[model samples]
Target: MRQMRMSHDEPLLAIDGLKTHFFTREGTVRAVDGVSLTVPRGKTVCVVGESGCGKSVTARSVLGLVDEPGRIIDGRIAWQPGAGEPVDLTTLDPKGERMRRIRGGEISMVFQEPMASLSPMYTIGDQLIETIRLHLPLGKEEARDRAVEQLRRVGIPRPEERLDAYSFQLSGGMCQRVMIAIALAADPALLIADEPTTALDVTTQARIIDLLRDLQAETGMSVLFITHDLGVVAEIADEVVVMYLGTVVERGGVDEIFHDPKHPYTNALLGSIPRMGAGAGRRLATIRGNVPHPSDRPAGCPFHPRCDAAIGGVCDVSDPPHIVFGEARSVRCVLHDDGAAVGGDFRVDGERA
Candidate 1:
């Protein structure tokens, strides 16, 4: 394993202009286009968007997990390991030994479906011990002990006996917990949780979120959480990245994104969330249309077809420029562009002028 020193000043992971595409027989599918974001040390950055918005693809891209037919066409994924120089993950071979070590040892991922992610043939302990042994230099018995300790840490009751059980024998919640334990067994520097809570019930989801937060507090690992649920973002996210049709539409601090969304897509998403006192029988606000098909993406701004605030002439004819607000906030929308010909005044502070 490679040794990496820690630095608090720089971001743990930085992805810039990442584009992952699939060269299918019919047409090219651009899954992640010009997507950029950073995962600051020990912070949770949640990537939010509707289904098929490339949230999962972007996460997979970070770990060099984009499968065959789908390869990164352009862009750079710079991973900074604090002490040494920054490594551009985009240039590394996906199946190479260096990338393989970084994928699970330095950066681990908790996938969406626990049951599907874990093998039904192997006992829970077998998988967990394998992961631990692969990353750490330990004897068989030692690895097993570490596996049991991890299960206990993840709040699994009777962890020793539970380890002997297969994934199919455990409840959904238990399977998810086991998956989490396995992901953390190697003590990765960054945890890419790809909608880990999406498959659980409301109560189970809450517990899982709480567990992640607690584990982060204990381990100080940065997390890249991918999900479509705004409520989940509100609970755990320090920062938020809103993606639309494979590109980032808006990104900023969680409080800013929720309270003062700059992009129409972001506003529409916020409005769609169920509220405490929204009144009975009231229709929840919904975005006009589904995400555009990857191969059939629109000419200009991808969100224009569904955006209520889209300027017909400009948004349809040309792509929106990325507008910057302070240091940590940005939006790609004609409505926020200063040069765009629109009726309402646009301010750099993300407000009406």
Candidate 2:
């Protein structure tokens, strides 16, 4: 994590062995399984994985957004919450008044699709004001003022006038910015953004990232940004968590995970990233197999079949112990076995039977 540039203070929020599962007709599907992570004050952690990797489920669980069939059957989400002990958010029911208060008041989330997250019937200004008033005991006029200020802070041009416009009236990028403003309206301690830039163009995405970074620095808010883009993870994440089939296979600072990736899954994900300019003309690398569906997860290590360096019998029969490379790095893979081409802490092979 040295390259990721962290301050090393205690985290504002910490997730410990969290699991989110859904009860379907067949069986329970584990979406987030025994995952642990921490977001320090003013630091960002990017949870990167392809679709259906449980990244969204993990984020939703934090905000109590999982509903109906999905449930937080295991683990704890502890938040610093100003000056309190790490409060376990999983114990709070979403509909309960206290949990409701905590959702938008202490913690906020912006969905991947701004259009879907925003009410089509409400004007942008009305929605922003509603969010502010929902958490704060401010009067209508004060809340409206805060809304306009937040809109302006997010770089929404002529925010006062545009506040009256509906969702359809604004472009995708503008709508995304409005979502950002809505999240900021409450001055929350943590922000969970799930693929927030999916609707915007590349340049607009960069601008949004810049705006978010600036706002986080100014407010000292911890952000859990959920995205599949390694490039985005590289640029914005102070720490990284890589997931596969509802499990965290690797966790470290952005530099350690990306530059010195130890897990085969992490290596495969990094290999798939396209290199341009100096690496031009080189064909893009690809990971052949698709992510396993929750209903039919492979036995043993979920990633063994796809891992090129897997030790035949070991990965086929058992899950590897999580190996710690340093204070800032850890990986879950049998490749950590001693004398491996890429080494960490692998056991010596016993003599042949």
Candidate 3:
């Protein structure tokens, strides 16, 4: 067998052509169709898209959390654990022992709804201790102490007291903090946070983002953050992947995606971000049309229907290739096709192309 070498350039997680589909009674719902991205070690990679764009499904698929009727049908999820071999996560059984060890031990996730994630029956301390003990070879007392420390690490006030409290006792922000604490209890190398700030207030959201950053800095762990909010992406992301429908439309560094978005969908998303000093009466830019249903997804370029830069008989007729722009940026659009104009800024007024 060939040995897997861990180089500095190797990504902590590399997903390629991932197709997570749900076989419903009506038809197959291609929730995450051929989505690919990478989370480098010690860096934050944010996947941004509107609702129903398969952002959550992609995150769930990463941890083998996709429920029944849905399964990862294709591609490989290469997960590099330290200097050891890179394991293919997609090939593992969802409920099998190896995956169990990998899920919470190698990679942990903080979900969107903290209240729902935490059990109402169990006290926070019990839950945290259980998770810690499950992943680590710690006795009950040691796990309990570690749980308290993890709570403190996440900035939960009076960590020892809060540990014994139920999930209902904590506010929304505090509940989220506890979720992060649980995720960190194992000291996983990769942390997958799925909209951890969606329901939080602005200040609380900022705090949560900062907390994650601090934790990453302390642990040197990579993060795969899934959110629709570009503001949060801008605040924390080192790399950004823009998903539309079920595929990655564009992906680049944070500044590249924000300043020079090539895909129409990406450009529209960047324009939609609210500015601080906008005119009082100006309306925020909005992307027109809704995300197409999985069953009713359009042929060829999935985004061509609403894309202003879409060329007639071209974009709707054939799928565009992944246009590579140097090493850090890649876009999926017809405007960047061979012999097509691939320079300058992308305007949404139907005039750029």
Residue-level lDDT of model 3, residues 1-353, one tens digit each, is 22345565699998889999999999999999999999998999999998999999999998899999999999888888767678888888889999999988989999999999999898999999999999999999999889989999999989999988999988999999999998988899999999999999999999999999999999999999999998888889999999988999999999998888788898888778888999899999887888999878998899888876777777788888889997769998877676654454546445663
User: Can you tell me which runs of candidate 1 are displaced by over 4 Å?
Assistant: 1-8, 346-353
Could you give candidate 1's per-residue lDDT for residues 286-323 as a string of tens digits? 88879989999998899888876667788898989999
lDDT (CA) for every model shown? 0.90, 0.83, 0.89
| Candidate 2 wrongly placed segments (more than 4 Å) | 1-9, 278-282, 338-353
lDDT of 3 at 52: 90
Tens digits of per-residue lDDT, candidate 2, 63-86, equal: 888987999988878777665355
Pairs that clash in candidate 1: none
What is the total number of backbone clashes in candidate 3?
Answer: 0
- Which pairs of residues collide in model 3? none
